[model samples]
Target: MMKIDLQKEFNDYTQNLNKASKDQHINTAITRAVKAYRSTVAESLERFPHTPEMAAEVREIKTQAMANNSELLAQAMASVERNKGKAFYARDRQQALEIAAGIIGTGKTVVKGKSMLGEELHLREYLEEKGNEVWETDLGEFILQLKKDRPMHILSPAIHVPREQVAEIFSKFFNKDVPPEIAEEVGVVREFLREKYFSAHVGISGANVVAADTGAMVIIENEGNVRLASGAPPVHIVMVGIEKIVPTFQEAMKTAEVTWRYAQYGVPGYVNIVSGPSKTGDIEKVTTYGAHGPKEFYVIFVDNGRSEMAKDEKFSQALHCLRCGGCMYECPVFQVTAGHFGHTYLSGIGAVWTAFVSGGLEKAAPLVYTCLRCGRCMERCPMQINVPAMIGELRNRIVNGAAQGEEPLPQVAHS
Candidate 1:
């Protein structure tokens, strides 16, 4: 009962995942994160009864976009170029990393918003390796940044950490008499991130939705840190998946509402949207690019097997996630095993994304059975996406077997 260290939980979850059988600690991390998400998203789900209808719309958006993927990509590319911004289409991770490195230059301190895409690219680690100072601005991500661990919950990075351990970590880092309270821990981080907001030379973020119509980048966050990250820095960089493209800002707004409701569970603690790096064109009746805004803006469109995910019947639904992370919370299996449920991406959704992006069935086999198969997450989804259904799809692939003796799943707790 020392209260779990979320950072430590992530560390332990990954470190011991392959070595030992499932333990209570792994269960603790997974369960706790899942619970937090489910409890909150449930209330929000009730707010909108149009969820089923909305889901159909979302599917339509996806279908229209995917059917003409090359055309959609062209539109998005053109829009970004028209906005006086630079866009790069990364065929894979290595290409994306190279694009980021060449643009970031050297000796610049970077402040990053919470972006799972950045995580996929290991952007912070890479920037650090290049001797650039990088700071995470999301409260959960910031804590994990201090602990140097991967994210547990997608939305809440430090969801694995209990309040008491958070107190300990914050206390040690601040060197102040940090209160042994969860509310206080959050407050402390808000205050701490203030300096990082203004001092950063560059900002890195992930886009929730990218509007192909206006070449606008839409970000949704409960905290205002993403706003500060993109606004404060002279240069703003967004690492976005190709699937994030939507037709218009109006469509983007509708999706944003759904995405926000999904994350907030009721009403978000806060929500912010950014349109091309905070520009001010009002002075002297002339527009300026760097006037209290970023002089340079780069959006990296990462393919990273997303193109592969588009064609699959069952698995393609993973692209429609909207980054809600609601499924992980509702998943009983994810609740206990924490990230044991995923690979880089954790939980049921992560399993699909991991199989598509990170590793295939061979790497994802152990995680396939972790689901309790409960439908709570799907019920709460604004798009009403069937996460459990997709997990089943992955399971079929595993049971059917692939690659011939690529290591079968260990006997986990649940089938």
Candidate 2:
């Protein structure tokens, strides 16, 4: 293996961080987003005062879920198969990509919902490379797709792209003079993706929580894109992390509720619970598959390092994250740099995720050091993940080299 240049990585990361911190678009967008998130989350908490208590209960649920992750994974896959949906377990990124490609094949148009997993696996880029046209249906994701940029926030992918820039991107893409009006911009994209939804051969999404008992994939979304993307296409494919599975449906509901609540959504516009392919029994009182919705449903449970993360006691809590994006609002570094402080994931929590799931420890070194360890993010985090503690453990491993027989640690310079 090529030796990683820790000095160069730190220098380049710092340069990017400094540059991002000074960007006017990132400043304006993050400021507005932080304010809105705080206000909305406060109101949401007040409206549903039970959320914190529910979150506490969900924490236990997550703890147990992580402990029995292997059992839950097997049960969930069996439930999916029982429900008539094909289930796949991908041990790594390559296997995940290959399975999806085998199902999708080449020369197909795919409309996909917003999925951080998709970003982690570079699913869209991979499919396109395999000769498929893929469209990101979420408005923010669509904007990023057109702008050729990655997500700046988990919930709000293009959070750094202000409306002015959006209008510019929209104008260039649509080949028209789209003004800097949010409504008009939305209308144009809505008009464009409406056709892609019905015409696309496949639709892809990520689940917020999975119920091992019923094989249900619960997706919480404010935007209606997931509904269309999953419903309109003949084939619906769900790519979710194995850590999302819970033992029971009721616990899954609790998990989903807490997730949306902390995500600043008082009540998400859509809570889709998909178990299997759409079916009907009308004509002769006989059951039939493929009504007006998707005829085929496939679920790929991606493990790509998540299993390893769950096994380690110090890092297992990181897998409990609901991806609410609330911690980013409270994170001082994230407030200033947005997603520049991250790799595929963002903020303090993201650093832990990058270390385990998306990118390994070496890739996560810069982000690990970026954390202020003020514990402000914990105050806002629904999971109350001890990110500072995790960061400290990562730093020790980086400095002293990884545990016996693990990947050799890079030579990182002390500040």
Candidate 3:
């Protein structure tokens, strides 16, 4: 893995925010994208009719679900096992990677669906180093994988890259002139990934929500890539944060609904729910696994500081995030810097997430301070996470030179 000084990078990006905001290419991309997103989301919300009452209900469900996290995890694991799937818990990033790699083994071909949790662990790099050929099947993740760049946005990985730049990237990648048109670019990707989907030995994905009652993991996507990636291979591995577990399937669907609703879609194009390894009861009363889709299904519940964060009420709220990209559209700072303003996660919610999940107060300090404290993010959030309030809390903790669960710094004697 590459070494990155989050503090230094944050400082540099903060210093150059003005220049970035003024850059014609960046400004054009962001302005157009944000405008389109806001417009579409407005229409989606209007059409879907998400009432404040519904939002409040979802909030209560998530709060209760999160509060009963341990019980839900145990139930989810039991449920997965009963469905003829293997379930594992990863306490941290290292363990997560180790478990995933052990399942994947080495010298195997793997195709991946876009997964932020996978990104959080740099899973591709780990697999590659272990001698496996892994490809990111999602178009956006594919572009970034080719460019060797981090995701600029959570949902839309290469949102910062203009179409022309993509044309350039694709041209070099394909060893031919690829047109700048979106359709042609998408065609090139589709054609290239078609073979990978069928040939890969393993498929990796992240779940939007895991139902504790049924052990059904829900994946919502506009692109069919997730379905293909998770289905084509004989072995399927799903890694999801523990916070994504909801108490029941109904609540899980509701979570998925609200997530894409605020993510600028009235309904996702595909909603894939996998309870376990593919089974066939067509064999005259005998149940058989591996009939189609993935023969073996594995779910890795990644704790990775979530259990710690869950203990703190304010920080626990960060886990309530639905991973909707809506808040970024409303964030003035993000509109300018794109993903540069964040490290792993993006925007204000990302600040709180980074503080807990990524590193600590020092790492998140730059982002916490960079937040404009504009209430737009809160207004737009599906989870209604009070980002500014959380940021203020982070700032207070940092200013007092205190770490989480520690006493504040002592005051120095003034001369």
Among these predictions, the greatest TM-score belongs to: 2
TM-score of each: 0.84, 0.96, 0.94
Prediction 1 TM-score vs. true = 0.84
lDDT of 3 by residue, 275-386 (tens): 9998899969799999889999999999998999899865687788989888998898899888877878888988888888886677788888899887688888877887
Instruction: Report how far residue 224 has shifted in candidate 3, in Å.
Output: 0.1
lDDT of each: 0.74, 0.93, 0.87
lDDT of 1 at 184: 89
Q: Model 1, poorest ten-residue lDDT window?
A: 406-415
- Superposed Cα deviation of residue 402, candidate 3 (Å): 2.7
Which lDDT value does model 1 have at 25?
Answer: 45
Name every residue pair that clashes in candidate 1.
Answer: 6-160, 6-161, 27-336, 30-334, 30-335, 30-338, 31-335, 31-336, 34-329
For model 2, what is the C-alpha lDDT against the true structure? 0.93
Q: Which digits, one per residue and each the tens of the lDDT, describe model 2 over residues 135-208? A: 99899999999999999999999999989999999999999999999999999999999999999999999999
Candidate structures ordered by TM-score, highest first: 2, 3, 1
- lDDT of prediction 1: 0.74
Candidate 2 residue runs with Cα over 4 Å from true position: 1-3, 404-415
Off by over 4 Å in 3: 1-10, 15-19, 403-415
lDDT of 1 by residue, 150-250 (tens): 78778877767766777888889999878888788889888877887788788989988888888878887767888888888899988899988888877
